[model samples]
Target: MEHRRLGDSGLAVSEIAYGNWLTHADGAACVAAALDAGVTTFHTAAAWAEGAAEEALGAALAGARRDDLVLCTGVFWPEGAGPNAAGLSRKHLRASLHGSLRRLGTDHVDVYQLLRFDYRTPLDETFLALSDLVRQGKVLYVGTAEWTADQLAQASAAARRFDVPLIANQPHYSMLWRVAEAQVMPVCAREGIGQFASVALAQGVLTGKYRPGHVPPGSRAAAGGEARRSVWPLLMPDLLDRVGLLRGVADDAGLTMAQLALAWALQHDTVASVITGASTPAQVVENAKASGISLDLDVLTRIDQLLGSFVQTDPRLTWSPPATG
Candidate 1:
């Protein structure tokens, strides 16, 4: 897999990062496949399965040399009933990192991300706390996820003031979702923050497995619960029909629909990596092929023409949940 520098930092990560958000049932096999495929980055979060995901990823990587991997995790979701169980306060950040380290069996995460903007916590407290983590050698770099442009500016300023190594932002960027391109990307580009794009396949929608009016058995949409809910909006008949047309584009380019989708997202220079999820080893190997494959300009134009009106580009659509009371 090709590796690129994360933002302006000297650290380089794989073009495709294996993320175990909702698909960690066969973590060991998938992780092994990713490693075999040359993927050096693995992303997980404390909120994913209430920290079980980290434990699974940690166990899966037990034999690999730690220095050879770029391990990333996120915080800011409530891990307990207490009011302080979440957010970016010093106490919570410290507690969360310690818990994450324990579960992940790691001394320090290569990148520790703030899963969301903490509305209640002062930015000063949050940045200061993060800076301390870096100083203590528990975190190598810091990042944010799903934060708005204004929030990114604020955080960038605070990061500078505290001398924090704020180098990346994890955003939900995909073929169907272009919200970040409107505002977040510009701000991050100026601030020297690269994007680790999540859901590059739109939760498997862009894989072209879901037909115009049919939800295949054993599909994420058919499984129900959170997976279904996450993909339901993109399952509209018109969108699915339009997505079906991309098969020709993929065929013409000698790429799978998934590969075309991933290549589209990686076209941007500001995107450091595309965080992909896999339930099986084959999927990991397939995604790794998209790393160095560059889509032609004509193919990009064709995609825009096909999904023009359906694309979600409203900057206001980028949002974060309010702090819990």
Candidate 2:
């Protein structure tokens, strides 16, 4: 697998990071497939399956050297009934990191991220807590997910003051969703922060399995749960129609729709890694191949022309928490 520097940090992560968001049940076999494919980074969240994700990941990676993997987990999701159990406050951050470490059976994670920006917490408090973790050798680098341009600037400033490593920002990025280009990319490019792009397959829509009139049984959207809600906006007939045209593009290039979409996302310089999910080990192998295929100018232009108006490039579409409660 190809490797790139994560933001301005000295660390290098696999271009394709194996993520466990909805695939917690896939367990060690799925993770082993990624490892065999040369995926050194494994990303999960404490909130994923209520920490079962971390436990499974820990068991899977037990045989590998700790220093060889980039293990990442998140903070900020409500872990309990306590008022301080969720936000970026020092208490929650400290408690969460310790719990994550214990669950993962590791001393330190390569990257510890905030699941989302906590508008209710002061930036200084969050940054300082992260700084303390870094000093204590619990978290090597800090990152945030779905932060706006303004929040990134403030985070960089805070990291500077705290003397901590603020390395990456994770966001949902796909051929169908280009919101990051206008809202997060420019600032990240300028500030030396890399993007850990999630939803590279648009929650499986970009896989071309969802047709205009047909919703495949057992598909993400058809499941009628969190995945459905997450991908609800992109479920329109117009978008699916445009997606169908990409089948020709994929056929011409001898690639699957999933590979085509994944390759498209990795083309950007600001993207450090394209995190992908798989329900099976074979699926992991298929997704990993996208890293080797580069979409030349011609194919990219063809994609743009095919999906022209269907692409959502508006900066405002990039979601951020409200500045105040």
Candidate 3:
């Protein structure tokens, strides 16, 4: 697998990293499959499946060299109902990191990220906490996720002010989602922060699996719980149409829709890694193939048109870009 630098931190990660939150303990096969398929990088969040995901990933990667791959995880979510259970406050950050390390079975995570912007907690507090982790060697690098330009600027400034390193930021960016282009991407570029783009497949919408009135049996839409049309409205007519268009482009390229979607996201220079969610070993194998393909600009242009006036925030985080500057 080809690797890209995570900003200026000198850490290189595979273009398409494996994600294991959705799979449980019984799904170690999926974990093994990812590592076998050259997915050296693994991306997960502290709150995913209440840490089960990290536990499973940790057990699966036990024998691998810790430094050979980049392990990224994030903080700032309700891990418990207590007041300190969530947010980027110093207390929660520390507790979360400790819990995460224990779950991941590692003393430290290579890249420790503030998963989201906390309106309540001051950015300084978050930066200080992350810096302390870095200084203490419980974390190698610090990054942000889903933060606005103003929030990111404040964090970066605080990092510099406190003499700490903030190396990366994870955002949603794909052929279907481009709002980061106008805001977050530039911030990272100016600050030399690497971007780990998530939702690159728009929660399987870009996989070309969901169509008008037709949802695959085991697909996310068909899961039919909180994840069905109620959560993401996969039945949206426009989304379905875009899927049809993308499927055609994938066919012409002789690539699966999922592969084309992931490849297109990886084509961006600013994107250090594209995080993928897999429920099956086959899915992991298929997603790994995306790491090796590069999409042509002409095809991307056609994709832009089908996506219509882009959306910055979709229900499932599959944002679209605007039509004009």
TM-score, each model?
A: 0.98, 0.96, 0.91
User: Over the stretch 1-325, how does candidate 3's per-residue lDDT look in tens digits?
Assistant: 7788888778888888887656554468876887788878888878888888788788888888887877888887688878678888899889989998998889889888887778777778878877788899998888888777777788889999876779888887777667677777778889989888888888788887777878788777777665575326546877788678777888998889999989888877789889987877898888888886877878988877777774444423422221110
Highest lDDT: give the candidate number: 1
**Candidate 3 backbone clash number:** 3
TM-score (C-alpha, index-matched) for candidate 3: 0.91
Winner by TM-score: 1
Which residue runs does candidate 2 get wrong by more than 4 Å? 23-25, 322-325
**What ordering of candidates by TM-score runs from best to worst?**
1, 2, 3
lDDT of 1: 0.92
Could you tell which candidate, 1 or 3, scores higher by lDDT?
A: 1
- Stretch of 10 with least lDDT, candidate 3: 316-325
Candidate 2 or 1, higher lDDT: 1
For 1-325, candidate 2 gives per-residue lDDT tens digits of 8999998888999989998876446667898999999999989988787888888888889998888999999987777777777878888889988999999999998999987888888999999989989999999998889888888999999999999888899988988788889868889988889999999899888999988878888777787778788876778999899999999999999999998989899999999999998888988998898886788899999999998888888777666563221
- Residue 257 in candidate 1 has what lDDT? 95
Q: Candidate 2 lDDT (Cα, whole model)?
A: 0.87
Relative to the unseen true structure, what is the C-alpha lDDT of residue 86 in candidate 1, on a scale of 0 to 100? 83
